[model samples]
Target: MSNRNIKVVRVTKDDYDQVCAITPPGQIYSGTDYLPDYFHMLLDMSNVEAYAAVVDGKFASFFLSFVVDNGRTVVTRAGRTNKEYAGMGLQDVMRRNTIKDRKYDKMAATSGAHVKAILDQIKSGKREKILMMEFRSYITSGDQLKSILNTIGNTTPSSAKPIDAIELGDILTNQQVSCHLFPESRVIVDWVPYRLIKSNAFLIKTIRTTVIGSNLENGTRILTFGNYFNTTAGLVCNIEVYGCIGETLAEHLYLHLRELISHEISGKVIIRCFYRQETKSNFITKLMNRFGLDITEIWGTGLVCTETTPEIYFR
Candidate 1:
């Protein structure tokens, strides 16, 4: 950490062009040649705190902090366009100290910074009930499934069942859970739905470069992704779960979706499930691990952090 004069400023729609021009190609999500509506959503989110770092009168990097409802913290998209700054070791600084000034502890950051800022405020002392932070790594189509299963090694119980798709959304309506957990988790429920689940085919097509040899037999187009609160949410991925059932069905479904997502969206896919009964049959977990899908962080029970480590915490 050099004594470089680095300043952090909130980002606006106007800065979007500069951010896009500078952000490395690797940092950009596929299908979106540039940050689109989702970028706007993250930047304008009411709960997030967005900041751009300026070093030597130029954009060096940016950090997006998000506060969960119960004092959980998250950061996303700490990026630097300057090759000299790319290796400046900002991640550790940002992770351990960036949001320390923000009142929250036990932060849970994600891949999108702008999204993180919205989530950071909720982690304030007022929401100290938050004990753990949760993060997800979307599994992609090309992930090494055999290597992953070999590690976790059938820790899952046979009787465990995939979370009922309906249950995915129902988690939101629970007032008691909502009171204890940060509203940030709501994003999953907000975006994932049967209708929205049906339209992701376009995204899959957009990221074809990463899906070579995926056993993809056909390509399907999404007619429409259903809307929530009048905004698009879920849609179908390139893979369809039709004619498949039970564990094998779950495994293939997850593998296929993981390939499409990981290749197309962000990083590898891993699931963190927090449940009362606590069994490891989540749709993504079981599906991935069943076929040795890929690196996964499955939490059948207990706190979120305990499971993230050694499972899939990037660093």
Candidate 2:
């Protein structure tokens, strides 16, 4: 291990093939997983920086930093190490090196397996500095998609409207939205963290995400954002649900799924719905059980290390 020199560098177009070649964990998610399909777009995304962990000369791992929440927050995610170098400390080195010089009020990471490590850091000191939030996702195919939508057909809010760039900006900037819809003023669409600001609106649009909302009196009561992309398994549609449960959640879920039919998109489509921790368990049970549709789930933890979080500190 001492002889191996690991260098972390900014990802470039030249690293595309190598980064894609790095073998991802063989563990299958109920959903599709691939690196290459998304790397190309990340290179040109606004305020997003992607890094590669190179062992000697090969791209052995990758990390991404998203500067959002009006530049006060840094969202770090998509960290991966090749199977060949799994046990080595390349990930720690990459985390430490990539954060140098960049300043932020806090750094947040979404983890499926490393949540406990982040929790350990929080336990070492005051817990308020380091915060934890849980999110869950369920992935289903086009057949299930059709079944659920058909079963729950005509049951969604008639007012759920797909907002354009301008309206999306308005919703994100609303104080009520920050407090209720998105906790801690952090807005994550699909799996990426993004600010709710109007300017940040175009960023999600670049990825072709559509924002839909209902019950917008003082603030939105139910909101959902999503987009789809090609993957090794087929086309994957990703949705993030916030501030709604029961029939309302189902309504938004229906709206998102209707995209395939409305657009006349035909293929083997995989739908992955990401929802907040607060969503009631019965909602999911009913959504599937009542309709006899099955949904495969994955759990994730959101570690928000605030500016004052000392033990879990980064930079």
Candidate 3:
């Protein structure tokens, strides 16, 4: 009993208005740019394949599909022409993405040698689990959301050492970052071995992290920031920090970083927070409770976000 058209397909430039209907305003508020640009970039990358739920032949709802970091990871985002799709009791739109997991994996595997090579590299890595992070808005009030979130904590692996053991560091480099030609910049480390690009296009800036202490504690803070590079996507910028801290510090750092990057870069910034290892710590649950970050249950990774875009380091 779906109203309006629901068709999932590769988006075209012409579909801007329809897609915008579901997306937030142009203001870089919340995580709007992630999807709109994601659509265009998908088309540009040609590595992206979209699927929509077309009802009545109109684009009622759509999900953006892309394999990033050379095919080592698959990311999909869904939105509807009307906001109803994301409302309570009607979260089916969010659920639709889970159905295509295997399909996308197979697609990435069969697409090109680059993906194959990336897979081989991942297979060789010592890490044993996949990590998935989802940054989304909090639909319900804090109390209710807390109840729901506590039930679903950050994604973690079943058979790995806990998050407490891993060391965390914030990396920032003042070195001149290199920018590859458009599109080529999207080349990832995993794709390097397969000849995807001459080499990893992501410009690595040698960043220095001020080692605060060796102990993994909850109150420590690490702040990282650097310049952006022109890639297939818009001017890419990154600000990241990793330390054993609570959600308050994470949110505080995220907020300050977002303001910092936004003031500096007129364009949109996609900020990403990466945790080193899995943590079943109540700290993760507390972070989820405070911030809107969601643990994408699909891949077992701890990912949080702010209105910031960190340079994508494929390696």
Candidate 4:
């Protein structure tokens, strides 16, 4: 329990179970669910570097970072501290130590306190530039879903089909193009490996649909992924939409989402958009407002700090 007894060590395959055992259950930090199996996968990844704060050989906190954009960036995937170890600053210690070994050009993260912590490091003279502040929009209601649907007007729905890595990669590329061209576009940083996608996809219970004319003559596709769980607040549906479709099509896609998952929507439907720059926040905020869905902003920040600037690429 003493501060001097705590030590930060590189996490190994042997530490997987202990790490998960100490991870706080449900919404561990910034709405991120603690997935033990996923944690195991991260531990096994050659590109991922993980660290843990241990006291007397017991896990207290953990942090994970992995190469993204083909080694151009290192992203902090998740960090959590055991409630029993609260107030010890274990999370900060793990983050500091893990990042000190960074071999990549840029570092990125997408959690509230963690983002602020990274910013503090930059402010303290770490070579870094604030790329953007990221935010998410949460919507929960059938009425609002309907309103958004009506606002978007008629949209042709494409057949439901599973998106392969190739198609997903193309969609992400288009997303990057949209981000560069549109002043109001929101960009999300995703660096997940192809091998891990299949396993994680199962937990999301996703619904995929295409919106005609949202992009070019080929149109755009929307992938809405989430799950419903019973909580004290009631049965809540948390959904995340991916694709670079414009605001109108984004709303229309949500309508199709409601149709596909109506049985799962119970007390509330919490829809979350990927992390977007502050400049593009208005596009999503306005859409959610028009639909009467309450909005909560999940704040995150990104910094570009590489010795040699690397070419930007979507991951």
The 0-to-1 C-alpha lDDT of every candidate, in the order given, reads 0.36, 0.63, 0.34, 0.50
lDDT of 1 by residue, 102-216 (tens): 5543444322223433334334321222223232323333235434544544453322233222432332344443323223322222122111222222222221211112111
Span of 10 residues, lowest total lDDT, candidate 1? 221-230
Which candidate leads the pack in lDDT?
2
Question: Model 4, stretches more than 4 Å misplaced?
Answer: 1-47, 83-103, 113-116, 133-136, 141-155, 158-164, 168-187, 190-213, 216-247, 255-267, 274-286, 289-292, 296-315
lDDT score at residue 252, model 3, on the 0-100 scale? 40
lDDT of 1 at 202: 24
**lDDT by residue for model 4 (1-315), tens:** 464588889888887778777854454534445345355655656667888898777898888876556555566676778788788878767766765645656655544434555456556544344334344546566555655666765555444444444454444456544343222332232322121222322212222222222333233534533334433333333333444535544445455355535554445555444433434666766766655667764323322322112222111
Per-residue alpha-carbon lDDT of model 3 for 1-315, expressed as tens digits?
544444446567778767666545443322334455445544655445555555566555655544444444444333344455444322244334433344322111111212343345346641221222222221222344334444544434222121111221111111111121111122111111111222112212112111122122222432222322322223333333233344434444333333333333343333333333343344644554454434332112233111111112112
Candidate 4 displacement at residue 105 in angstroms: 3.9
- True lDDT of residue 105, candidate 1: 35
Prediction-by-prediction clash tally: 44, 0, 24, 0
Q: How much is 298 displaced in model 1, in angstroms?
A: 22
Which residue ranges in model 1 land beyond 4 Å of their true spot?
1-3, 26-37, 75-81, 91-100, 110-170, 173-315
Q: What TM-score goes with each of the models?
A: 0.39, 0.78, 0.36, 0.56
Whole-model lDDT for model 2 versus the true structure?
A: 0.63
